[model samples]
Target: MSEKKFTKIDCKELKLGMRFSAPVFFDDGENMFLGEEKAVKNYHINAIQRWKIDYLLTYGHLVTDGKTAAPDSIYMLEDLEEVEEA
Candidate 1:
């Protein structure tokens, strides 16, 4: 299988058809998988804006291996630690 790449995009830039590479979460670490793969939809976009989510990870292509590819960044690790501590 080919490696998938994720790009960090501001929530404001999100649009329909962009597949989420990872589950989105609230500040309290609540998963926002409203649907399969958390596929972006009109309501999802509105909800994201209403929740004030500034950024999200998405990929233009799908992963056939059924594994989500996380973005490559140190900030992600820090975020994970914070979530674990919460």
Candidate 2:
């Protein structure tokens, strides 16, 4: 059997204007939310926070402007700083 692992996205990383690289599912892991078609807005974050949802499930990463942020992209502080400088 193949395993379909899901990535968890903390609500904290969600910000206004972040467009997902792919669709994201709700915590239920069934219902879909952020489709790549649209960028995130204030109300989306508001609703997530109001519902006390700390995280979301997805198979992809977040895209902002022209940058794609993978969940696994977390690395050393120096690397992050280097990215910021670029």
Most lDDT-accurate candidate: 2
Top-TM-score candidate index: 2
Error of model 2, residue 44, in angstroms? 0.3
lDDT of 2 by residue, 1-86 (tens): 99568899888988766766668878998888777545666678988989898888887766546654434234346568999999
The models' CA-based lDDT, in order, is 0.55, 0.74
Determine which window of 10 residues in candidate 1 has minimal summed lDDT. 27-36
Tell how far residue 74 is off in model 1, in angstroms. 38
The segments of candidate 1 whose C-alpha lies over 4 angstroms from its true place after superposition are: 1-8, 27-30, 33-36, 57-86
Candidate 2 residue 58 Cα shift, in angstroms, is 1.0
lDDT of 2 at 24: 81
Tell me the tens digit of each residue's lDDT in model 1 across 1-86: 99545555666776665554365444333344333344456677788888777875444333245544344354358779999999
TM-score of each: 0.41, 0.65
